[model samples]
Target chain A: MSLEIEVFATLNGIPDEAINNKTVIVIDVLRATTTITVALAAGCLEVIPVLTPEEAIEMRERLGDERVLLGGERNALKIPGFDLGNSPLEYTTEIVAGKRLIITTTNGTRAIRRAAGGRLVFLGAMINAPAVAGLAATAATDITIICAGTRDRFSLEDFLTAGLLVDQLAGQGEFVLRDGALAARDYYYCHRADPAAALKASFHGRLLADLGMEADVEFCSRVGATDVVPVYGGGIIKKAS
Target chain B: MSLEIEVFATLNGIPDEAINNKTVIVIDVLRATTTITVALAAGCLEVIPVLTPEEAIEMRERLGDERVLLGGERNALKIPGFDLGNSPLEYTTEIVAGKRLIITTTNGTRAIRRAAGGRLVFLGAMINAPAVAGLAATAATDITIICAGTRDRFSLEDFLTAGLLVDQLAGQGEFVLRDGALAARDYYYCHRADPAAALKASFHGRLLADLGMEADVEFCSRVGATDVVPVYGGGIIKKAS
Candidate 1:
């Protein structure tokens, strides 16, 4: 029997039963997962994914503010009084290295939390797509790619990232692609040539451009730019050691 | 300003604000909407979409069952005690003509009801896509295409049907394609040549084929085969007059 893969454009409407026994790849390409990938690659100790900005603040208080940094966004702008925003480029090695990162966003963190039933949950984005897919393929018999769509709506950027991962994963071995996977795989095939253009065309991507964060979109658009696959367990995400 | 178009793979997360003042096109190509279009074209008096088989039966009882037909499916099979299943082939002129269809399905009917806030609601499928799009473009300044996804998950056939509608609507006039519309439009572009193949590859399509309904899939795959655009108003759907 071949492996089975399902892709979800958003986390809404997914039943709890769908996640059990499957390995999940959570994506929020513009730019929660992308930012997390960058933070981990830059040597951040770990990422604490909370659902809301208020929760992020509370977590920071409990963790103590010394070596921890808060990062997130609402409406594509940095949260007030946070260490950083959702832009991936802000997590340079010098800025995030050796720090504990607590992150939340308008959509990504909630999606990560809701995908908790999966036996294994790995954060995947265009930046670490190839490596994430390579690692995830061997993790379980079933794989679910859950895209953190913008504000509970299907975001094109995340769906496209799923397509990218599906395309790469298809090369590994034979697999049964479910409806969402088939759609994303085909969409990825259609838009794979110009990932950056695809991102720039997305709703969040255009919003980011309007906010002068095109650099973030460009940074998140580079497929396989890094090989860091952040795994989540017990509400914490860390680089696979 | 040009028209605005947004396509939803499923009706789950659509906000009421999104539907306000927009013409909505509800699609369920395999085969709720397809069946409705066929029944209407065959001269069914009207299609009253209810949420459940029980509701369909109740509605039939309330209406005195005279010249009334109950049609629906559960898990793509005929609902028990219903006069007909969801297969478009069964909704022939000989069977449905002059009858009132109290119709229900697992997903399609709920989608049609949920789009109640729309300024105008039109059912569009591959069978009558071109005419629906042409008429819908003139009915309102904004259009929202809602796909009745299979069991609250993204259904490839519905998405493809939405893509086909988006593609046809694009040709009718200039429009600003939102994220969902852009994704559907691109998906349609990828698989426009052979829709039957697309349908066969979907989760529900394969199930119907397994249940000996390959002919139904082929029947729904033919684009622009009819000009019957069913419009829903005042809780009843009838051929556009």
Candidate 2:
């Protein structure tokens, strides 16, 4: 089975037709996807991404607070009354087990909701790039990497992750890349030499630094921290068993 | 002085702040911007891009048919009464000089109008990449590259051109790149090895080829055919002296 990989640098860059019948890999390296991956890897059962903070709260109210942990941010700061902000470090295994997280991040999780129609796979900087790449290769359908860019715009961090994934896949030599996929691979190579420098110089990175989340930038830039690949099937993103 | 380059893979990928205080370069390599650039470089005095054919007719009625040439396409095919379709080959110098061409393209020109608030520039497969790079390098303000993606979605051809422009600017070595600019350059390097393959694999490129415009694809892929850089100032696009 030939798997066609399509890389979108921003959520807005997603093609209308490519959304159908594909396994979509949603990546938001700076925080949202990173936070979710960490939360799940840390032993949180599942995370439900909502479009807005109010929607997260509403979902929480329905699911009941005892089992659900409220998470997310507004302008990179923790939401008021939220049990957690969008920090991967906050999601420790000791703090979150068998709990459902209602999350609404500034860019990442919201992008996840917009891409709800596809068979979704969530990725972040912490995940092993090779693992994500392997998952993409074996998916048996077209792979569309939807970079959950910052605020409807292209983010370098997200695109960089996509590039890394493409790079891993290209090394396998098992798949035929479309132009978008090849482009992603090239982008990864361009920034691979100095990722930290690339991250610090990005628009979102600077903004995150300005918001006092410089630590998040460092955290998200780490490649292959988790072998756990979170797959979104039927609207809920969970660790692939 | 610092020059910023904003790359848009899709109309939706446009950054919020890019709409303000930047010289916007419109790129629709499949056609639109390519056609305009070709027409102007071929000696068309001025090309007025409108959103609709009705407007072209209105302009024709108001400006008189003696000098007005109706151009553009609905689906890569020429409008019923228009003088041209959205093809670079159709814009050869012998036919377009000293003429007022009323044009409406599928994506490129519309994007230019949409982001009209910024200082406007035109980019395509043919002409003035280095000059555009030079202009961007010397520019004191941020530059936005608006890619006329296929049908409100991201097209690889346009994004690749944006990347190439970004790559050239990065090579200039005197300017610091914003994250967006760097991302565009990364995208360029990703697609630079084979522009024809990149274009053929794009959503718009396939559509054009299916409609029997293989020649247009070749024409659109030729880089640096002309050094005349088109700039949109005073609400109309013309050659920047």
Candidate 3:
């Protein structure tokens, strides 16, 4: 079987063919994937991704707000009246444990929805790179890694996370890599020694830092920090059992 | 001042915003840019790029057959009755010197047309990377390097060529790089010691080799082999004087 690393530089860049019959790993390391991994690890029962804030709120109402927490962000800030912003730190055990999260985001959720037709969809980040790669290697079909770039443009953080995953997947078994995969692997090697430094220099990283979220970049760059692989199916994400 | 390397994995991947108000360098190093650079270096007066074979034939008819030569390929093979195939070797001084050529191809010309709104457009390849970078550094606006990916899919060769150009441009001036540019530069550094080896392993390169075009890949991988920078303006490409 072949492994194709198809990076959608932005949510809008994903091609229709990428979402069909493939094992898709969606990454938005700047926050979304990081947030999901942390939430699941903190014992959140499930995370439902919606494209819009209204949809997130509606889902929360349907599930009963007492049992569901509204989460997500717009323009890198928490949505008004929502329970959480996109930061991974916000999904603490005290707040998220034992509850369901109805989430929407500026980029990541849109990308996840776009990959809804995949045979298997998983949320990946540096935090869960090895775990995702291990699961991905056993897939019965081709694997595609899609990056949730920032604001419909290329985001360095997402591509770097993809590179880390590609590197891990390559080590697990032999597979034919697409050009994008090769490129991502090469990029990962270039920054493998110092991912935080690489992230600090990225376009989105700098933007986030300017917004006083530099700690998030440092947190997101910690490879293999969590073993949680959040699998998405039937409209919700839950830690794979 | 900034230099952005916007890599479109395929022609279909280019964003609408990437084509405006920038100095765009279009690279299709597998053959088109290599051929165009060679044609100009061997003394072709001008090369006009069109999206279809019929457009090339019509342009030749309008300009008279004696003054215009039809040159291009549909599937790495010459169109029947055309003056030349899409090979740099076919653009010898004896046949094409001082003549105008109308060219079309499966990928490159379409990418060129896509960048038509740019303040300046130039054809780039490994053969003319330094030359293109030198010219691009002088642009009053930002420089955007666009990879004409293979047949609506990402091609390894084009991205590597873009990386080479980004590396060259980075050395010549102070410029902020976009995430795509950073990825390209890092990729180039990973394989800078052996570009031909990297190209030979690419999907398109292997396909071309199977078709007995191994020599073309070797020729196209030669960095700084030519000084010709083919500038596109008024819908025609000519060696920048």
Candidate 4:
């Protein structure tokens, strides 16, 4: 089995052919994957990723807002009517446990939808990189890590997270890496020792810091802080259990 | 000024919007850019990149075969009846000096045409990396480097060469790097100590060695071996006089 990592600079940059039957890991380290990982680790029932706010609202209505929490952000700010923003800190065990989250974000949800055709899709971030890599390697299928870049441009945080996952998998399996994978592995090796510093240097990181969310950047930079491997299937993301 | 390096894993992977008004550097380090740089450094008047064998033949007809030499490759082998193959070794000063050459390859020329919409396009490779970086830094425009991956698939050689160029430019100018640029720079830093060893470990490099072109790989891997920066303007690539 071989691993081919395709680093999409943005959702718009992902080729249509990239999502066919492979195990896809969607990474949005500046906080969608981190949030999802936290939610699952905190015992959330499932995270339904919707592409639009209306879909999230509709899902909330169907499931009853009491049972389904609406969570997401637009332009890094919390939606006015939503129960929560995209910050991983909000998905604490006290709040998210046993609740279903209908979420939509500026970039992460769109990337998840784009990757729906994969044989299996997993949410990956620094917080749960080892778990995701472990699951992916055991699957023994070709993997494509999609970076949910900010807006329609590349995001260094997401790419670095994907690189971290690639690094983890490279040690466990013999795989044929694509050019993007090789580049990502090199980037991971170069910045592995100082991920927090690397994240702070990114465009998205600076933007988040400007928004008074530097704490979230520090939170998301913790590699393997959680062991939850959130798997996406049947239109919802949930822990492997 | 800002530098945005968009590393396309393949020619098909490049987005149409990436070329607008940017200074684009097209890299095919395994051969095309290496050959072009060598030809120019060896005193060739110009290298006209064509997309097809017919166009090369037509250009030879238009300029007369005596003045225009035909060169390029289809699958690492010289086109039948062409004056030369896509090899830097064949571009010795004795044969190509003072002659104009029309070239086409499986990937490089296609990538150049893909980047034709740029404000200025330049050919780049490990052989002429320093020269290309110097020209790009002096241009002081938002730059985008296009890697001509092999046959619409990621080629490690081209990407690492782009990384080398990015690393060089990053030191010469103050520029905001895009995510891809940062990744490329990291990759370059990881493998800068010995480009030939890095190249030999790449997919295309292994294939070239299998085809008995180890010498070409060695020649192309030389950093700062030539001072010629080949500029593509008016549909022709010539030394930046």
Candidate 5:
């Protein structure tokens, strides 16, 4: 039998047992996972995802201010003392190269922490969809795609990003897409021709645009913008070799 | 501002607060809500929804088995000794007319009970999409559609049924679709031309086929097969007139 690929519309929607032995692919396309992929691809040494702003601050203190940069957002804006906000375009090689970054956000980081029990956890977004799907195509265990929706609710951006990955992995012809994945695959095919239009239709996409962050939406909507798949292990995310 | 209409992929995926003071629509296309709509359209008195098989038995005894029928399924098969299974075709006018039904299912009935917090709880299926959407169009509060997914996991059959409702409610031009609703509307439109094919694409639809219940699938997939909207309140579901 082929591997099973399932998509969850939100982090809270997933059962604990689904992650225990599966290869988990996490998507937060509006920004968190997208930003992580951009930061790692821009040459950041590694990113440590923290759940709260206070934890991000503490990580900065413990890792020493010289090499660790704080990057995150609260309500889609930069934290008061953080070096960067949660925009993928903000993480250029000039700023992030060779640095250890600590990040936190409203939804994405919490999902990463929740997937810690998985046999393997890889952060995915539109920018890194095919690379992440390639990882799934080679996994020994079944794959679970978890969308890090905004504030315990569904986010279309993450869901479509999950769909894009599903489309890619299913291309290997060794997958049995399950319920959510089954739905997502069809949605992906419907919107594949114009993904940016799909992203602009998302609630978070409009939320970001309302906050004058359309550039972030524009940046995150590009498929295969980079080939970096950030794998999470031992409490940190780094571009897979 | 357009009235907000949100779609939840599963009963458990929704937070308790999402249903309060809202108009909630529950769906189980394969085939709890479908069966309920069929039974009511065939002139059944009312459906008493219970959470457990034991509660169904208790209800049958308390209501006096002489006039009451036990109708439910566990794992898609008729519960042993029950009068009917969770199939739309079984509740013919000859069998269900003028009788009270105590019904339970693996997903749908529980979803109806869980939506008790809503200002109004209505059961939906492809069989009653237009009528249920008419109810939402006139609802006093924002709407929440809970898909009675299979065993806490997302089910496309319920989801596409939800999308159908979303499409119809949005047709009135006063509803603002939220994240899940936005995604659902797209999926619904994609499959609207041929809804039967869409149901056949669902995980549960194939499961029913595997179990020799293709007749139920055929029955449930017909859009607007009946216009009866079953509203659940105070522990019983009845035709909304």
Candidate 6:
């Protein structure tokens, strides 16, 4: 039998088979995925995802500070001594051009590290979701979408973004939707009327608002603004080749 | 912040929050949930879900067989000396009428036992998707959907059914879909066009076919055939009053 695609809402929800020998698409739409997608689209060379802050520091040391820039966030705050934070706004072309960024984050990067074996792609609101789904549709292996929710809990922004992506994929021929995919699509449908409002209402969004980052939430919710799909391969994420 | 409703593709994936103070809907469309729904809908008085066949036998002794019936399955076969298997077909009106069933199955029943704390509702393809969603939507507590996947792995059938159910709950206001919920919904959309073919292509379906039970696969795919929503309360499932 051919491989069947499966969608998992969280890393914890992913089954052994969904991870084993499968192509996984990881989404952290509130910030990380969106940030990375924008950074790459804005002409960043590559992003090396590190599991721990210490690892990012070590990578920066090995790669040399002249060529490598440090980028990460802990609890959505910029790490001390880092060149940039986890916001897409901070990853503009003027700063990230021709730079290799060593990045770490609380949830999204950890998920990327855990997903070392699978064929991993990073999706954001900027990318045309249909393009990402099209890439998944052509892959011979089973597809697993892992949403990097906030701190071991479900994040609404990520779920809705994943749903929008899944909704696009479901429109393709002969594809079967699983419960996780259906949940994502339905969630997208539920929030499709007002994505900015949905993002603002999220737990992370409220935290960001408390931290005075309401503009970032609005920016992240704007869909299809960019057409870049950053696929994670080797040890870094680059614009999908 | 209000408690968010998180769904899990399997019992093992349930977060502490979703496992506690939540009204969990456990679904095993390949049969446990479907069979229980069919059994109770067919007129069975009550269904006691136990973790093991041994536990089921012990309860049978205490409850007495005057009205109780031992029911279970292992590897899709009837447990030795049990009155019924995990087959919706066996739960016909004539056989299950007014009887009490003690069930312990491989995947579905075990998931129900592990999901002990919540107000558990057993769901199957038989129930109307809207009704399952309505119960979750109107519940006083947060909702968790525990899909009884095959042997702790992601089973397409259970997840697709969960997606169908979760889709109904979306857009009810003041609700957020978790990663598990998103994934299930994505799965549902992917499979909605041709559910039977989707079921036939699942890992469990292939195994069932190897065992020469392809009929069971087709039988389980029929939606909304039963209206019963078997609520697991007081450690037993009965038609919710």
Complex DockQ per candidate: 0.80, 0.46, 0.55, 0.37, 0.69, 0.18
lDDT, candidates in the order shown: 0.90, 0.75, 0.85, 0.84, 0.89, 0.75
In Å, residue B30's CA in model 6 sits off its true spot by 4.6
Residue-wise C-alpha lDDT for candidate 2, range A1-241, written one tens digit per residue: 6667777767774665677777777887778888888888888998888878898888888876698988988887899999999878789988777898888887887677767677555554535567777776776777777888777667787778888887887676566676556666767787787777778788878988898878888877788877877777676888877
- The C-alpha stretches of model 1 lying farther than 4 A from their native spots are none
* lDDT comparing candidate 1 with the true structure: 0.90
B1-241: candidate 4 lDDT, tens digit per residue: 3455555444654555777788889999889989999999899998899999998898788876587789999878999999999989999999899999999999989988888888988899988899889988888678888877766455778878878888898889887777667767777889888879989888778888999999999999999988888999888898897
The predicted structure with the larger lDDT, 3 or 5, is 5
Q: What TM-score do all the candidates reach, one by one?
A: 0.98, 0.85, 0.95, 0.90, 0.97, 0.73
What digit string (tens of lDDT, one per residue) describes model 6 on residues B1-241?
A: 5545555655664656666677788878787887888888889999989989999889989976787888878988899989988877788888989899999889888788767787555454535456666666788677777777766455667777877877767756476665556656655776688778877877777777898778888888877665677788778788876
lDDT of 5 by residue, B69-113 (tens): 999999899999898988888899999999999998988888888
- Tens-place lDDT per residue, model 2, B1-241, is 6555667667875755786777667777778777877778878888787888998899889987687799999877899988888888887767888887888887867887777777445554545677777776676667777777767555777778887887776777565666556777766666677777767777667778898888788778877777777776555667767
Please write out the lDDT profile of model 3 over residues B87-178, one tens digit for every residue: 88789999899999999988899888888988889999999899999998888677777778866556778888888888898888887788
Q: For each of the candidates, what fraction of the native contacts does it recover? A: 0.76, 0.56, 0.56, 0.40, 0.64, 0.15
Local error of candidate 1 at residue B160 (angstroms): 0.8
Docking class of 2: acceptable
By DockQ: ranked, best first: 1, 5, 3, 2, 4, 6
Chain A TM-score compared with the true chain A, each model in order? 0.97, 0.92, 0.96, 0.96, 0.97, 0.93
TM-score of predicted structure 1, chain A? 0.97
Residues A91-179, candidate 6, lDDT per residue (tens digit)? Answer: 98899988888888888887776666786555545245666777777776667778777765657677777777777766664656664
Given candidate 2, what's the lDDT at residue A233? 65
Ranking by lDDT: 1, 5, 3, 4, 2, 6
Task: Provide chain B's TM-score, model 2.
Answer: 0.91
